[model samples]
Target: MYKASCSCRMLERKGILCRHIIWIYSSNGVKTIPDEYVVNRWCKDALRSKSFNCNGDPAEEIDIIDAKQISMSKMWSEVHQTVGIPMGRSKEVVDSFSSLIREFKEKLAPLGSQMSKEQEMVALIGCSTTQEVTIFPPKKSKNKGSGKRLLSSKTKAIALAMKPKRMYQNDN
Candidate 1:
């Protein structure tokens, strides 16, 4: 896509085609502008392209800071393989899971950063085994705490529910 865009730009610079022509066509050039090419390529099917012309080396990492731009499924499959998890019945599990985890992290980041060192460690005690912190009842203490008494699990859930994290929403 980058190649196509750049070539179009260069051609327009020399007046072989106008920016209007490129905008309308938005496809590869074989040295001629067929009027029909503009209409068909602009149709919805062209939006399904898996690759983008990022204008960098194919090996270069794509800049992905926003939740929408990032493909959770792709990243998740990679980590799943690295951890030696079997290629499961659905390879897309990790990506779906990662996206969830990423959104959760973006939400929790401010709360975590605001925490004191000790609080952060306590949160870590919960998050260490799980991607997002899910405070469970302590293993050794058999006596259950009442709902009136806030435990880590209840506290974390309440925090998450009360304020949907707004920190990363700007990426849209």
Candidate 2:
């Protein structure tokens, strides 16, 4: 077993090995990364199940209402993967895909707009609250070189008095 550590601590922070660790592994003639180092979420088998918990464990109980949501999510993922393969190959393909998306958007617009403003906001932000949410404006900031430089009235008058006038001469 080869033991190595990086000063960057990328593996500890992001669960991804740093270049130094990778170089050490390469120099040691390691054929594959050890299973312990590989993060489960980045693996192909991560989503083998229909849905999983945050701890990388298969959910023991699935909600009845969420069943349809999970199925729809799976179907959409498959559809996206299938349609994304031949994208950008030709102009005809791009045009056809754009028109298809537009057609679907037109058809779905009415159904989407059926929801009230509050319902739409909840759907967009994924949060619903019984209490009123008052979002105050951001604090005024004085960033360097943002607004015009303020000058005193005396300075302004001095500048105006010192201004150069253009003298035009007539050629007779």
Candidate 3:
């Protein structure tokens, strides 16, 4: 068994081999990554046995039954696989994929959620209140600065324009 290490210590910290170590292995005619370097935590089935709630009890597994949700989940998985291909190719390809994903998010934002912004936030944060909660507007807090009215940009611009301009008087 060939043993090698890199100064980066990527394998030590992240449980993944660094590029230098990969390069060394490739140059040494090592056709495949060693089984020892591959961490169990990164494996797809690693979390299968770790399904537990905060109280150390096994969490209830909810199976997806909704046709739309099932379809969407499958579609997302497909998209993820497709995107993974270009990730190792080039910077331009990755950037193009990023912009495409961003555009999709922007276009789908309104269609995804029917609730108001505040309600959407509450839903996203998983906040369930027993009583109906009324959210009032935030009260204005006094600043530490001495109470002086700050001049607005428009007012400052007007003040600047009203200032007397120095004209050259002909000196005989």
**For model 2, what is the error of residue 96's alpha carbon versus the real structure, in angstroms, after optimal superposition?**
12
How accurate locally is residue 72 in candidate 1, as Cα lDDT from 0 to 100? 68
Candidate 1: which stretches are off by over 4 Å? 1-89, 114-172
Better of 1 and 3 by TM-score: 3
What does candidate 1's lDDT look like per residue over 6-78, in tens digits? 5446454553556655665555444555643344445575544344332322343445576743576678777
TM-score top scorer: 2
Ranking the candidates on TM-score from highest down gives 2, 3, 1
Off by over 4 Å in 2: 6-15, 39-67, 70-115, 119-131, 145-172
lDDT of 3: 0.81
Tens digit of per-residue lDDT, candidate 3, span 1-172: 7788889998899888999999999999999888788788877867655467533577677555789778988998998897787766788888998899899989999887578876876665555333655687899987888878999999999999999999999989
Model 3 misplaced stretches (Cα beyond 4 Å): 48-58, 63-68, 71-128, 131-172
Query: Residue 76: error of model 2 in Å?
Result: 6.7
Would you estimate the TM-scores of all the predictions? 0.17, 0.39, 0.37
Residue range 1-172, candidate 2, lDDT tens digits:
6677899999999989899999999999997888789789988767555656444566675437677788989989998996796676898887888789789889878886688888997875556655755697899987888678899999999999999988999999
